[model samples]
Target: MNDFLIPQHVNSFHRANPVAKLLCMILLFMLTLFTHRLDFVFYQMACFLLLLLLFSGHRFWKISLIILPFLLVFIASSSTMILFGKGDTVWWKWGLIQISQESFYRGIHIGFKSVTFAMEGLLFVLTTPSVALFYALMQKAKLPPKYAYSFMASIRLLPMVWEELLIRRNALRIRGVRSLRGGMKWLGILKLYMVPLLAQGIRRAHRVAVAMETKAFDGQGERSYYYPSEYSKSDIWVILLLSAAVAAALLMSILLPPFGITDVRYR
Candidate 1:
């Protein structure tokens, strides 16, 4: 299942060192936060969207499904400010609900910012793998192997845990155990499902801990990695691409006609 979910065609972004990619993402995030102009934010979003479409290596429908939630995010984030935010020029007012020119601009700016953040995050996730990320953290970022390996183990265990839950459900069905309906359904789930799952998880964790201890995982001795995380030309390309995106966004924002909003903070 996990193998099917990942794209078969590995792009340059996917080949880049995870630590370098992470740092680039953090820098982009900080830049977006400092950006207050609507035009700039919009262009930043456009750049990210273009990058995602070009390099994600996924089907159009799959990419669309991944980004569908951000539509709701844009709406929810913009609506609150548009309806209730303060402004000098009132457009419409009905008791608590108010719409103003300033508020409308501000809301749109905020919506664009939110979507830009989401796109950047999706771009990272679509390119980077969980296993690669932990390995990169340990190798490139100087993170302790014990912590990195523990996180990797936990992530790898998730699929097995999900399978166990499905098996338990099937077993109950075979035993003619009907699911509880109405308000008490949740309580029944806690008693019948949650308790066993929690106990199983605890026992599994203990066993893993014991196994790690036997292998001297907690020790400070140097160890070789099965999957080596190393810097390459791909990392440099990733950095250059991101830098170009940022530069292009700034250039477009400057060349395009302003939305009459210079600084959103002043408004």
Candidate 2:
């Protein structure tokens, strides 16, 4: 059941220009940051979730499971601030902490804004592949080839790092070594595990550097790309649609001032 909602690797959007997706996500992030009204934030989040259901092809519950904990933590911290801060209509009182209507509203606003930002971020993470993003950056964003290749190489090495760590752990296990389970000291765990992982990472980095030099990867000058990224009509549509959404949100905030136009500050 959960598998059905998982995103297909070979979707049309997956093949769409990564630059467009990146720019659209940036617009959404800007919207998340500037909007201050809780109602508007909630409305935006709801719309994003609905779109995710329709288009993400990823399990809604799985993403929610990853997102909710951070949201809850943010809410808790915001609630703490509201409880401690001064406000006009006090609901509860303690020696240093007091819950009041103004603080409560502000906290709610902050919490919802956080959710809006997280949802936008999740959309990017779920849709964009790392290689595609790096390729787009190099071709479209005019990022230096060497820097882009280095960044992509680092990302590609993550699986190798994990594999090496697992192999080390299994070997240790076979020799009756134990991890920092059941309240063992973390410092000891780090000494046992992290040092080897660091060594392996450094070794891999050295090999990658050597390979890049072998390929004559000078950061500057002309280079040919095997998978040269190009903009398409779909990319234009994506950009226009997202830009329009951002503009519409801004316009709505202006016309309906109460929705989100006002600058909210904790007072």
Candidate 3:
């Protein structure tokens, strides 16, 4: 349980300050938003994906499995622009559907941007632990203890909630209860599962609140943390590495001739 709650470090990147890594992610997000060149976006997406594969400390197949779902995200994000966007060079046209060269380029660019965003976010989530993140925010970002501890409490409760749900499901199966298969199906599920879950959650929350009150956690006085979030030289290295990635992507975009489409906005 302790091991499940606290993730082991995969590499130096995983050990870097959570606050620093979060800030770097935000900076990368801002950079991605301003970038309009399709080639630039592609390079950025590829760079992040490569970093994810390298530092995720998983086998190639495992990483591929993790990334498989983002294919859907890419398709879903780009489809709209490709199907209906306005442009001069029409490739195909039908009733209420249009495809053009500029739209195709724009759609691909948007897809790349979306995938890059997901990759960057996944990189952070895969590397950082919830406990460490909340603690980092509290200590370094000056987040209030009340809010941080509440977030931590919610994280702790999630596994137990999942376990309870499984137990309830098993119990229902043992009792020969089957779900309804019609218009009333969703309502039946809500009544059977959601009600119990909500009731149990409320009870658990009450108990936790009382326990916290008994321990004087409500006080605003300075308190010592069991898991201290600290900054070290590795944080600087993490920042430098991410900055280098951004620079490399930009350089790649500049050196390689763009795919005949520079800015997606006017083209």
Off by over 4 Å in 1: 167-192
lDDT of 2 by residue, 122-221 (tens): 7666676677788888889988888888887887788888898899889889988766566658788777788899988999899988989788774576
Angstrom error of the Cα, residue 90, model 1: value is 1.5
Global lDDT of each model? 0.87, 0.71, 0.86
Name the regions of candidate 3 deviating beyond 4 angstroms: 1-9, 171-177
The residue pairs that clash in candidate 1, if any, are: none
Model 3, range 234-259, lDDT digits (tens) per residue? 89888888888888988988898468
Model 1 TM-score, all chains together: 0.88
Name the candidate that leads on TM-score: 3
* TM-score, candidate number 2: 0.79
Listed per model in order, the count of residue pairs whose N, CA or C atoms clash below 3 Å is 0, 1, 0
* C-alpha RMSD in Å of predicted model 2 compared with the true structure: 4.0
